[model samples]
Target: MNYWLIKSEPSTYSWDDLVKLGSDHWDGVRNFKARNNIKAMKVGDLCLFYHSVNEKSIVGIAKVVKEYYKDPTTDDHRWYVMDVEPVRKLKRPITLAEVKAEPRLNDMQLVKYSRLSVQSVKEDEFGIILEMSEQ
Candidate 1:
């Protein structure tokens, strides 16, 4: 399964909110590239739930529970969304600052494309982040 990082501002929607809901539609992605990534998602894919802006960290893991479908809010239907369920909470959230300081994670998209809402996480990078969070 493909692995990705999905960003949401804590003030807008925190990790706690997702854990409370169990599963919910991930929508309101206005960027074309982010929307394309959402469209590419399939059931069972894993996502790193990252709190952007103030929190600036990877707080939890989530699994895509449903594949992409037309977003009801848009009449033209260019946008799509998927349902995701929280899988696990990190022992403690790993900060973006810590990620950037690690030389092993220098190549990660999380560092290179800081503003991208949805980005791929390389297998090695994913393992490294999980390892770091465990510390």
Candidate 2:
């Protein structure tokens, strides 16, 4: 399955909020690139839940339960959203500094496009982050 990283500000919609809801529509993405990425998602894809702004870390995991659909928040026709099921929280969050310091993760979109809200993650990158969280 494809892997992705999605960001949300902890002060707004944090990982803890996701865990409480269990599953919810991933909406409010306004960036063109991010919007495209959300639309490209498929059911069963794994998502690394990243908290942006102050949190600045991967706090949890989620699984795409529903594919792309029209976003209710937007009046535009092309904008879309997805449904994601909360998977689990990482006991230790992998910070941005930790990620940037890892030589093996140099090619990650999270490293290359730091401002991106939605990004693709390679298998090795996913595995490395998972291993780091374990540590």
**How many Å off is the CA of 42 in candidate 1?**
1.7
lDDT of 2 by residue, 1-135 (tens): 999999999999999888888899998888899988998899999999999999799988899999999999989977889999898888799999999999999999999998998888988999999999999
Give per-residue lDDT, candidate 1, residue 43: 91
Clashes of each: 0, 0
Q: Which stretches of candidate 1 lie over 4 Å from their true place?
A: none
* TM-score computed on alpha carbons, candidate 2: 0.97
Error of 2 at 107 (Å): 0.9
Error of 2 at 32 (Å): 1.6
Clashing pairs in 1: none
TM-scores for candidates 1 onward, in order: 0.95, 0.97
Q: For model 1, how does the per-residue alpha-carbon lDDT over 26-95 read when each residue is reduced to its tens digit? A: 8877788889899888899899999999889999999999998887768767888889999999998999
